[model samples]
Every structure is written in C-alpha cells, then in structure tokens.
Target: MNELVLTLGWLGIYAPMALGAASSAIGCAIAGQASIGAMTETEGGYGRFIGVSAFPSTMVIYGIVIMFTLNRDVTPENAGGLFGIGILSGIALMYCGIWQGRACAAAINATKEKPEIFGLSLAPAAIIEGFGVFAFVFALVISAGIS
Candidate 1:
C-alpha cells in the first residue's frame, strides 16, 4: 500500500504535463486541419488561420505551469493532495483543449466564409481558454496550500 501510494504520487506529479501536451497536440491538429482547409479556399489572409489554430496550444502551457506548481515532495501525507490536484487539473485542461480546438475550428471555418468577423469568431475559443486558465489558477492556489 505504501508503494502504491508513492507510485500514484509520482504519477500525479507527471500527469498534468503529459495530459496537457496530449490535449494541446490533439486540439492543435484539429484546428490546424481546418486552418489548412481554410487556406485552400481563400486566396489571402493565411496568418489568421494559423493564429486561430494555435490558440489551443495554450492549454499545454497551462499544464506545464500547473505541473511545476504541484511539484513538491510527495509523501503519504501529501499524496492525496497531489493526486487530486494533478488529476483534476489535467482533466480540466484536456477538456478545455479539445473544446477550444473545436471552437477554433469553428472560428476558422466561419471566418473563411466571412472574413470581417474573424476577430469576433475567436470569442468562443477565448472563453474556453478562460476556463482553462481558471483550472490552472485553481491548481496553483491549491498546490500552494499543500505541504
């Protein structure tokens, strides 16, 4: 049981970054595909599509910050905190990444049809990023409370 607890604690320490990177990769890929499609359809303004596709990459950065914030000596006393914080934050970031990708893809598609609304189309992705930021902030605050 002691070994299991310590192993899980170690898992907790790494989970955020691993999960976050995966989320970002998937999100970026999804949006990037839409970006490519958009580029093929439009004659100009390629930069905005690339920019929108990159929005979901922020989740990976947030995950990195959360992982570092949660990095402390994990003993039996702190294992629960590590696990809860690491896992919960990872899940939140992953969801945010996925949804943010979808949102970005939508933005790219819509803006491809109506170039004038490009900035406005990004609102949903920005809002999704806000949720990821909340999770990141919550993890950091809670991790500070742990020993």
Candidate 2:
C-alpha cells in the first residue's frame, strides 16, 4: 500500500538516529563500567579510561548525519531505497558500536594490568570503528543516488 510505503519511508528516515543512539548507549555503558572498575584498581590515568569509554559515542553522531542526509520527501518511489539503506547502515553502525564497546572494555582491562600497552590495546577498537566508518560512508554514497 502507498500509505505503508510512506510510513516505512518515515521510519527509515529516523531509524539511523534512533538505532545509533541505542548502539552508543549500550557501547558506552559497557566500556564505562569497565572504566569504573579499572579506575578503582588504579591510582591514576583516569582520563584515558574515561576517554576510551566514549569511543562508542561516535556511532550516534554518524547516525545523526546520515539521518540528515537521508531527509527528503518520502514517496513510494524512494521509500524502499531509504528504508533499505537507512536500516542496513543503522544495523552496521549498531553492530560496530556494541562490539567496539566490548573491544574498548577489553583494552581497558588489559591496559589496567599493563599500562605500557595502552596504545596497542586500542587497535581493536579502532579497527571496529573503521567498520562503522565504512558503513557510514556507504550509506552516504548510496543515499545520494536514491532520488
């Protein structure tokens, strides 16, 4: 139905931001809990723990940007493209955020034991972030051709 299509189009337009926020919230919470635990064990380097916990927040920003980019008149013609790209990219970003959080938590736990490996420990999280970037870029590029 045309109404269903337009409704889905609207859902797609907002899905990225909503999903991304959920992703960031879960990711940040996971890393933040580890950071808190680590902080209690260590005497210093509190800043880095807090910083690492915030890494997952980037997904929400990406989502917001993608939402804006996808914004337009939601008609049956473009609704399917919007839904597919928005939902798929949102899922990718969400996956990245959640996994990145776990990675950051791992890094925090490891670095708490061996402070010298701080930089190296972050590699996994950075790599996860890269995957999110790829999704973001793909959405942007593909959405441009939608209508």
Which candidate gets the maximum TM-score versus the true structure? 2
lDDT of 1 at 50: 96
Q: Rate the local accuracy (lDDT) of all candidates.
A: 0.90, 0.96
Candidate 1, which segments miss by more than 4 Å at Cα?
A: none
Provide the global lDDT of candidate 2 against the true structure: 0.96
Count steric clashes of candidate 1: 0
* Residue 9 lDDT (model 2): 92
Q: How close is candidate 1 to the true structure, as a TM-score?
A: 0.98
Residue 29, model 1: Cα distance from true site in angstroms: 0.3
User: Which sections of candidate 2 miss by over 4 Å?
Assistant: none
Report how far residue 111 has shifted in candidate 1, in Å.
0.5
Candidate 1 lDDT, 1-147, residue by residue in tens = 988897888788788898899999999999999999999999998998998899989988988988888788889988888988898899999999998999999999999989999889999999999999999998998898889
